[model samples]
Target: MYVTFVGHVIEWRGPAPFYFVRVPEDECAGIQEVASAATYGWGVIPVSARIGEIDFSTSLFPKDGGYLLPIKNAVRKPQNLSAGDEVTVEMTVRL
Candidate 1:
């Protein structure tokens, strides 16, 4: 399943801060339908995603009944993405 949407980058402070793009509620509904087929385990969904021409593979984390798309540094640096930035994501769920 493939999906595209715009989301705001958010920062989560842990031992180290992390960045993510929270998937919108509307998009979550569609992803839920295919969640079972795509999730490897722990309700986390595997996906190939692109941001500003940088492509990477990561797992969507379940949060607040929705999903958080982790934006890794490898993909962030080149794109100059950071917290509070609005970004367009092209993602594909591998079933």
Candidate 2:
């Protein structure tokens, strides 16, 4: 399924910094409908996404009843994105 949303970038300070864009609440419902079929394991859903001029594949990490789309450094740097920056994402849930 294809979906598009705009959200702010957030950082999780692990051993290394991890960045993500939270899927909007309104979008969660449709994702939940296909979650069971789409999640490979541990509630992680695989998706392909486009941000700015780049397209890449990544998995959505389930969190707090929603999903967080990881923004890899490869994609982020090219687009000049940083934490708290608003980004528009077009994604496809791979079912």
Candidate 3:
């Protein structure tokens, strides 16, 4: 399954700090339907994600009641993205 949306990158200061983009509530709802088949465990949904012209693979983390799309440093560097930046994201769920 494929989905696209714009989200703001935010810094998450967990045990280890990282960047993430929240999947919109509407998209999250749709993802939830297919999440069981796509998620391996711990509500981690495997997906191929693209930001700008860069593409990478990562797992969507379920937080609160929504999913957070991790924006890795490799993807951030080339795209010149940082926390608080609004970015267009395209994701293909690996089911």
Give per-model TM-scores: 0.96, 0.98, 0.95
The Cα local distance difference test for each model comes to 0.93, 0.96, 0.94
Q: Which stretches of candidate 2 lie over 4 Å from their true place?
A: none
Ranked candidates, highest TM-score first: 2, 1, 3
- Candidate 2, residue 72: the lDDT equals 99
Q: Which candidate model has the greater TM-score, 1 or 2?
A: 2
User: Which of 2 and 3 is ahead in TM-score?
Assistant: 2
Candidate 3 weakest ten by summed lDDT: 75-84
lDDT of 3 by residue, 1-95 (tens): 89999999999898987999999999999899999999999999999999999999999999988999999999998888888999999999899
> Which has the higher lDDT value, candidate number 1 or candidate number 2?
2
What ranges in model 3 sit over 4 Å off? none
- Model 3 gets an lDDT of 0.94
Cα RMSD for candidates in order: 0.7, 0.6, 1.0
